[model samples]
Target chain A: MRRVLVIEDDPKDMAITRNAVLRAGLFPDCVATGEEALSYLLRNDCAYILVEPCVKGLNLPLILSLANKRDRKAAIVVITKDSSLTSERKLREMGILYYMVKPADDMELSMVLQNGKAD
Target chain B: MEKPISILLVDDEADFRAIISDHLEEKGYQVFSVGSGQEAISAAQEQDFDVALLDVKMPGMDGVNLLQMLKEIDPSVEVIMLTGHATIETAVQSIKLGALDYLSKPVRLSELEVTIARALEVRHLRRQAFQLRERLRQKEAFPEIIGKSRKILAIQQQIEQVAQTDATVLIEGESGSGKELVAKAIHRRSKRGDGPFIVLNCGALQESLLENELFGHEKGAFTGASTEKRGLVEVADGGTLFVDEVAEMSLACQTRFLRILEAGDYRRLGSTKDLKVDLRIIAATNKKLAERAKQGQFREDLFYRLNVFRIVVPPLRERKEDIPILIGHFLANSEVGPKPPPPVSPEALESLMDYSWPGNVREVANVVERTLIVSQGLPIRPQHLNLTSREVPLVTCGEKDLLPLEQVERDHIQKVLAAVSGNKRRAARILGISLRNLYRKLEHYGLANSEPLKTAL
Candidate 1:
């Protein structure tokens, strides 16, 4: 089974994302803060990393760089409330697999993670 | 026939209450003055009041408490609090308890009247917004045609204009291009909107079956005719009867339909009595109906009668700009997926725009629904769309080279004129321009004779 690292500060959103990942036949390693997410990435190997950009203590670009160094194959998916195209381009340039705005359908996230990449 | 605005005045002082009540009555208001909060509650229980005035300092059940109680009784009642010993705390408390407004004691009669007027205006606006929301919610009650293109705007205008009369309407469009939606719009807007709107597809049944289904059969009229049946015409008596694919109606059936169009009367098969019904007929066809009528395939007289009001629904490809809006609407309203269907990716939207939807708006709905299921819990991408690589033709101009702007306009006007058989008025309507403007263009292009017709104004 694949392992998914779920990083969400919101308790409700984290629970929903964990459930979706578990339902997609993947084990979820959950964290509430960006510092915890960075430490978890350093100590563990996971197939996918799900994140929210607005989490406390989040350095999204640095987190993306660390994830890339730790596991070059990890597919980083950013779910954020900022729907600006500038942010999307910056995230995409950092090699994130997908950028979903807030109110992102949980079911789609499960499918995207299950399939590895949306392409 | 308008009812007077009713106001309930509650003030402990008898002399003050009487003076205010008399002044309100002189201004043509039905004023009900009560000496105590209990009496005001009793009066409210007996009948409804549009507005209520409560004194903040009262003997029992003060104004703030009474405001809460009155709101509980009828949330629609507008309550204004009056205080002789005015304080910010009591004013804030009164408003927090749902008081519409608060005023200090010794308020001028004119000032009080202005407050009442403002309260009534607010209530009126709130009711209007609620009614508008309710009407929008009823979108599910009828087929909603959604598009913002000039072609669609013109069609909507035509529906509104034709809905005011009982004229027979002919809607011409390609297959799957929302002709039924236009018919329903006309019916829903007409005076007969409250009445039943029935539909019958002319192309669905064979000639004999179609006539039997339309006119219905009397008992013993045929071998399987065990009982008399009411036709769609009778069911739609007070409203509208929409006939779809009417060009496919057989010649024999056309003759029978012509009778109803000419005189609102039709007899059941094997029944001698003529049955009359009052109904408006709106017919739709995907075929070139005027040409078909001239070719002796359809009844020319029936064609002329049904063409009293003509509405042309443009094909989806012409309104491609509305594709994103339509897709969003379909995805949001779709029941296929769980609540909140996944969004479409930008690449997927571009692919959708590239394809020529030969089946028109209906095809877009089907594609969206199918993609929702296949994509599951993920944003829809081009792979989920599964469309073949077929790009829509940009233009169908005869020459590969681009024509000048004036020439393109002239050519389009000439083609539309020929399609409508040189009816300038109908051409102008289809072109979405004023009749005078169309005439000027025609003269500028030298398409029409210099000698204008008498009705050319």
Candidate 2:
């Protein structure tokens, strides 16, 4: 079982991701802030980190830096509502393996997780 | 016959007039009585009184003269000759002069009140009915934005959710994909609907002009600034400011705009005082802002700031199901005469679906409008469509003897496989054939040494 960490501020979005992960038969531990997520990764083991791009006080750059420090070999997936080619290229260069647009269907999310696990 | 029911009492008898006023006031009616004929004329000038009672025995202006003057003031003012005499011819002459009724000595208030009430009710109902008809007429005259496609419905849902809040929204889509329409919808649905909805196109002007356009300038801020002016931001105070093509805004302007977003205040171009405005910012862009930020063209901090909430409008090609509906809508409203040519043929629609719409919704609208103009009263045929062939055309290899279907298929498969490089798993996937089938086909075609096949694991 792979441990997945989801950092999101919106309760509704967090719930949707949590339910979708469960529906995909995967366990996802959720946090509302980036600080909480970093602490969780430091104390426990996580195979993947899913971060919302515009969370309060936990933007993409900050989250990427924290993930780099953990050295847990966890794959990072940046979720954003604005899925431009620029964001994709930047995230790819930052060592984040995948990027998904918000409101992504269950099938797309499942594919990303499965692909990340394989990688 | 019923004692000329309504009467306007005018007298110089202080005690007698008070008694008449009291009696008239008791009954449910309107009474405009004055102490003198001069007062009577002034009161009648103000509004049309149903009846007027004048004293025939006054000093300067007698009842006869007052009655004539009142008639001159308003022909509609009913005059009731009031006198202390029983002269028959005087009464007959008064009646001849258009006096409604004659009252002898004291007048009864109950009779006058009932008659006036009945007359006023008729007038009130007529006005009420007229207003109701006018309101109904207005409602039917205007057409509303219509459609219930999932894409449109989703946009409507987002409008409803974000409209009530003051959060900044970033609308992303290809040009002509209804970005402005969505912005308008948000403004209309928001609490700021009654407030001004100001739109500033960031692409239309240079950075200096745009800065001055957004933040007002004092007199002589620059060579062109001969007079003081309030910018769109200040003008849209207490409402919404929609920045269209926001990605085109210069970095200098973006920096200032970011501060306004954070502090909710900004200083005029040449003014020292910072003007605080309460407004909702709704910015739109066709460019990928995130990608621009990555390229160092757009500020990363500003991108994150404006991207508090994002509504991505799907391009027209993604939602082909809506094309026909949009066509019908645009056609119905088209200036083209009644009875537009026949509906678009199935073949034309199929061709349209195959052609990628690079310009998105705006392009689709332009094509529809152009088709209507060119094919007036004729069925819209594929030939009439101005579709550009952008897709790769399949090559024809023969004059009479065409290349074999298997050979063409094999060649196409080999091309795609080489492009992705010969990972059998990926190559087989791209060809939409089983790996075993692909391998067998390669052997049967005697092309097993194809570069893609060599790298096959």
- Each model's DockQ score: 0.01, 0.01
Quote each prediction's TM-score: 0.50, 0.46
What's the residue-level lDDT of B203 in candidate 1?
64
Instruction: Give candidate 1's TM-score.
Output: 0.50
Question: What interface-residue Cα RMSD does candidate 2 give after superposition?
Answer: 21.6
- What are the per-residue Cα lDDT tens digits for candidate 2 across B313-377? 98887777777777677777665535744688887777777777887766666677677777776
Q: Pick the candidate with the highest TM-score.
A: 1
Give the candidate number with the greatest lDDT: 1
What's model 2's lDDT at A1? 80
* Residue range with the least summed lDDT across 10 consecutive positions in model 1 chain B: B448-457
What's the TM-score of chain A alone for every prediction? 0.90, 0.81
What is the docking quality class of candidate 1?
incorrect
- On residues B185-261, what C-alpha lDDT tens digit does candidate 1 reach at each position? 89988998887677777765456656765786676676544456456676677888889889989998899899999
Query: Chain B of candidate 2 versus the native chain B: what TM-score?
Result: 0.57
For candidate 1 chain A, which ten residues in a row score worst on lDDT? A110-119
Shift of residue B301 alpha carbon in model 2, Å: 2.5
Candidate number achieving the greatest DockQ relative to the actual structure: 1
